[model samples]
Target: MSDDEFTPRLGKSKGEDGKRLVKYGGRVLAAARLAGSKTGVLTRRFDGSRIGRGASIGRLLSSRDRLAGFRARRAIVKTRLVRMAGNGFAAARAHLRYIQRDGVTREGAPGALYGRETDLADGKEFLERCRDDRHQFRFIVSAEDGAEYPDLKPYIRRLMAQAEHDLGTRLDWVAVDHFNTDQPHTHVMLRGVDDRGKNLVIAREYIAHGFRERAAELATLDLGPRTDREIQQRLRRDVEQERLTAIDRRLLRRMDAARITSPAHNDPFQQAVATGRLRKLGAMGLAANLGAGRWRLADGLEDTLRRMGERGDIIRLMQRELTARRLERAPADRVIEGELNAPIIGRVIQRGFSDEHRDRHYLIVDGIDGRVHHLDIGRAAATEPTPEGAIVRIAPRSASARDVDRTIAEIARENGGRYSVALHLRHDPSASQAFAETHVRRLEAMRRAGAVERLSDGGWDIAADHVERAAAFETRQLRDRPVAIEMLSAAPLERLHGADAATWLDHAIASSEPLVLRDAGFGRDLRDALAARRQWLVEQELAEAEGGGVRMKRNAIALLQRRELLRVAGEIGSELGKDYVEAADGARIEGRLTRRLELTSGRHALVERSREFTLVPWRPVMERHVGKPVAGIMRSEGIHWQLGRGRGGPQIS
Candidate 1:
């Protein structure tokens, strides 16, 4: 049956929707029972009450047909297990014990015993291989009020009888359950497990054929006329169905190579950078130490680093004024040739800016500065755009993962649900649907045991005895307060890489005396140029519970590690390139994955199963172009610049 039909929802209290007076609610509860027993998404309104109804997204269920469904569930699932009896009687007993115990648990009862002792929880090693951590699964069945089915119960019995008689099995009961609501439903927790500890070996199509033979037998008894194929045909729910591309198909073949999203630890900075942090470094000029003694502007150094000081009036007079002033040049003048051009250079280049551009400065200094260092915004550090589906479906951040898990577990546990396992099926129906169904059952079991309280509105409230974080937000909020920043000293900033006592002083003084500070050029040295960074860090620290998160540009991070801040620093004395810091090093490097390449070491990478390439096409970074911008300004002819896959992409050509 299809599980996508909608049914009435009810409450459980007096005037409560679940009571007999509220027939619709009673039906909802019945359907909920079915939902609880199966792994289908149980979507509920996100609130704090039971007023909102919840159900499995896979299929709709109701009250009336639940028991009958249970009968079918019992019989069908039982038939599936009877085949195991051929191995021995222990297998038969194991199946029975598993079904009874598992069945009770599905109906909001405290569960004991992990399946049958003889059968492994998954039924067998091969089965375990096919399933995620938790083997509990519910077939997603969608049912609507108009959905018609012949009296298939008798046929189901016959199928069971045939299985019992043919297999010479001791177990004969049918398996089924019904949600006592309008969208009739049932969850079949079978009576037996295999000696090897598996459910059954029958393919869905094979079962359909057997049911057809039994249907003919039942027709003689005056049962309604419905084909087995009809029953099998009515099973689908909300989920994407697509013929994957050749690339995507190969990717699916290896989706399970990596486990679900959970790791003991990972670095955010490295993750951000490796994932291609951004298409641009943003408004603030990147403080790059080009491995040379100092940073070189794209035009090369017009003035020595020592000469560019805060103490210099000329330094503070014009450049910083334009930057800090944040002049909003008239759009008409975007292209320099007239008023848009600073009188100094008398020309403008139409360097396009991304939508998120902020604090733009578009003017270049002439011979006065020696090198033409055009002040601008947006450091284009681009990476290939992530595709829509799996290839780019990064595992949610750890924090996000923790939140989803905790929220789910908490709601379940509060209702006395025990989430022994959760498997990320990764675009699979079994994992997403049946997994959800079983989870609901566990939560209901907890509810039955008074472990949790289901709110009429939504969400859940746990008993005081079961005090624990049930959701990520709550869990995160519950951590004992972090060490306060007020207790820490402000000095030693010089010891810390980015923070210097001077930068803070400059920022504070700037706030107090902007004019005076600007004239004195007091904001000089490393602190002078990176005044914004210093301010940003201070603000960041103040906002966070602990000290702020410190980060450096990948290039700057590499340069800063050395005693000097220039391209020359990479020399034996400076040790720049030789001792360059990797992304995941203690020092944080934040930037996009501009491009990557493998050296010509002749070392072959591990061959991937994918038909098309998944591994990045890398060659050793052709002559590192750190301080110098490689992709120079391209004169664009048309409105849009087209780029191809390889480095030869038409980028504003």
Candidate 2:
């Protein structure tokens, strides 16, 4: 190999002459020694080798000083990694779209996406080529002085070179520079395969510790170690920062159990910075002078500062999303957060990852409350896909099992600690076959999950505390589903008026719930929609003008809802190239999964049972079983899939 080509130097070794070769700074030294030092006392004050105690202390202090400066500059660069697990190519595409989103440059231009081998403008073909890779890796690197440079491509290239040198192989990667935020950052994506066509596995320590250290080293090389003046200036500025800062971290660490902070015990410079921070915190009611150079900290000081920092981040996200959409909101409106007690009915303005590094998601909704709300909706897969302009209602999801759990337990108690579809139908003969089957499906799901015991006869031996166990099971599953989403209308509000189907506007007007419309943007638009629908109702002769108010005919709402369902069914049937088939109460349905279709009423799954098919309420579980055979009983609410993996055939009612 040429001198310029990289080589891996693992360790020292012995030659044929029995000489020890020690590796230092990538060079092998044979029997190396301190050339100028005396045998016992050592003459040189300091050299590249260890000698006397005085020289050792001096060298130690020198190394620490250099390290201190390095650490101070390291804080300026942020490094993060995102692992693309399943459908890596799809993830690669999604990440490219996100990083290259419009207005992500300093000049408000669309981010120019580029990879090592291909420009992002032709990203589709490049991603298709990468489809066979097991996984992809996305990395983000941002420098504190990144904005100082007109373009960040050179710095990114330098960083990647450093990575290649450290990783001991040529890497396959792509990158895009994003400059919209305060920090100009680069998004780098790497194919998971290495130069030898083998899976590239990076150590967790290397990702967490090594990558940032190298990035910081490169940054320091470019920008130079921060001067004492620069460091002091930053420390002074941190005194008044509203969010968590280095000063706050220090204070939290140094405070006594009595809630008192005494910076006098620290270095003179740190004492001054801490005093200034305490004064600033005092102004914010987070600190108080306890006399004698000590200050009393507020209870939950760290938590309060963290929350404030989070709120600031949320505001920035809301503003960035709004600006990208060319929309604006009033500054006076506080961003809603945490668990909401009631559902927010609105049209989805946009949906995207909130924390891309963590795969957490968020939504921007134009709510009926007259405000554009930003909601952090946890994982993206927990909720169904909602296209922009789709009307949806978002409610806080509960971990506890529903009343259905209690109903199943009662049925099991009546049937000798067991429950089955046949037994359920015999006991509740008046109940719709679909409804009874729904209970059986619930039991089947619980049994499959090992939350409840299932007998060989397709029945559950549910205990009195089955609901509690179900809730515990849900909690153990994951904290990914924080919000329950229901699609109210797949079509936009403007297109719903004058249509021959029922719309959300009609229900809002005729329902007993108070019409609380916000008089801004989408809220005002919805108000206009409600008025227009009222007029349409009169024109359709569904209601008559009575004493300055329109009087709807008896069961008009029910009639309109039925009409909407039939119209949706007709459209679905047209899509499937077959007639709409409604499953009878006791009818059994079995078929290969087709696809899921969204309608005005709700989302439905099309199950083709050999030339004929029926639309059933779509369940999330069915997504994995698509294009595979499924068996279930048609129940009142929906079809229950026969997920046969247990003792008796796993069937849903």
Candidate 3:
């Protein structure tokens, strides 16, 4: 017989020559030995004894209770699966950048600290291998400090190995250890596919309960059971924590008559600890004694504590920033909260992450008020980069309707309760044409939002409460533009000396308003800069030394502004390879959008016209229309953009 004869002869089992098999025959063969383990099934022992009919029910209940207890005890790992959608190339780049952000590792370094099951250096290539993968995984895992003896990377690797075994396939994953916060944790980015190259769907229970329990089990095995002294110490620390402490959680669980009663655990040490915590809370005004076994908890206790905790963090941040700069603030000027009575005029000193995990940002400004203010600006993307040394105005943010709404209402009232571009011009013939067009754009925006109705003849039906409606609209948009930043001057302080521009320093010197000078950080620096600027002006013949004081030219502000515009135009001209063309006030600008440049004033967009080009205030809409034609009316203040070629097309600010 040949080797092929040893192989079983193949037959059509589904055909008439063979017997039929039961449905799910493969499952039966695979789980034949575990048939008795199914729910609601009773098992018989070899001793001719049978377990109770409710045995499986009890088992199910026990398993659920165990999981619930594990979660309550905080003996579980934190794991998340962040999906990577859209273009594979963009996702790959973003993922790598995110994991490599500052302060990501235990050593306070950039990039991941560990890689599991594969080489860490080949992260890009690993990402490329799954370029066609529809969804990728970024799993974050954190374990309790139970196993403090071993390195976090090896423990994480063991967990991943266990996962591979349970899933019956190999996995490709990379991990990073972050110790920047109180919690020491690891971030694991795993490919969504299995070894055979198919989408791997993990069961929700496995992700939620199984992974955590497995990690906990391995940690417990390595470190042994937690000592009583450690457990008590943890509880003691929790009692004094500001943000949602464990004691508060326990009180919530055992509340009666709006108060927490002592537990009847019969453990004297635990009972004494609970009573001591109650007494501490009473002293802090968070709890009060009502009787032998009752207490009165403060209203909104949790919220107040959480706010205090946040303020504490803010204080710590302020101190750190000041220390790093080798600066100090008076105790009264150290902390600032709520709205400000007056705007703080200052130079930006530094920018940093306020809540690093959430990407919230903060700016450290050296104010002329003789103090450094830490301003928490909401998000990073919406914030314009106000580079260090740029003077800025930090006012209490107000989200109210501006004068534009009032102007619109007055124009409409004069036009028989109807507002149109032509009617606006007729109402205010003295107003600049571009300015009149802005009111029309405002009306168009209101009409689109359904706050005002547009008539068939290109006029708006102005209501008596039109101003109120517009105010409501502005309030609704406040969430995105939380702060309104007014640019004083776009030129850097260093270039203000002998520069062909009327910079902020020049404006400060020429204006009648008093300059609030302080002998402090940035303020002292500004004083020296202004003195040097005067000398530079005298040397350039723009100023003359008269009676021991410098006097500027009569049209110095205007001349400097013009010279600066020409200098900026020259720079843009070189970049675009076209001549500079200045657009007169109210002139129509039609061109293809080029690129946006960030200057001291704000963002500006270069518009490439036929043989010449110009720079105008950049609008968000122009970003999407880059390389496409854009038409707008340029005013002294800003441009009122027509989105398309047609006059009746949509307009944007």
Q: Which prediction has the highest TM-score against the true structure?
A: 2
| Residue 257 error, candidate 1, Å | 41
TM-score of decoy 3: 0.66
* 427-530: candidate 1 lDDT, tens digit per residue: 23354433443344334434544556655533344443343423333234223111111101122223332442222323332353332221111112224433
| Candidate order by decreasing TM-score | 2, 3, 1
lDDT of 2 by residue, 3-84 (tens): 7898888754886788986456323222223454333434465433343112333344345534554234552333344445
Please report the candidate that would top lDDT against the real structure.
Answer: 2
- lDDT against the true structure, per candidate, is 0.29, 0.71, 0.68
Q: Determine which window of 10 residues in candidate 2 has minimal summed lDDT.
A: 25-34
Q: What is the TM-score of each candidate against the true structure?
A: 0.17, 0.69, 0.66
Ranked by lDDT, top first: 2, 3, 1
Q: Tell me how far the alpha carbon of residue 297 in candidate 1 is from the true structure, in angstroms, after superposition.
A: 64
Q: Which stretches in model 1 have alpha-carbon errors above 4 Å? A: 1-159, 165-208, 212-653
**What digit string (tens of lDDT, one per residue) describes model 3 on residues 1-653?**
98866878665558465666545765675576476544544555553112312233334433664644222324445544445564345645555667677876667788663566443556677678767776666665666773353457787789888878766778888877667656677767777888888886665546655566667667776776667787688777766666666667666567776555553446676666677777777888888887876777787777887777787777777787678867777756664534455677777767766654333567777777677777776555445656776778766555566687887788778877887767767777887666766776777666756788877766678887888998888776454345544555445566666565666776776677757888876677778888887787788787888786678888776676667667788987887689987778889998888788665434678888778998777776576588888888776677778775465555665
TM accuracy, model 2? 0.69
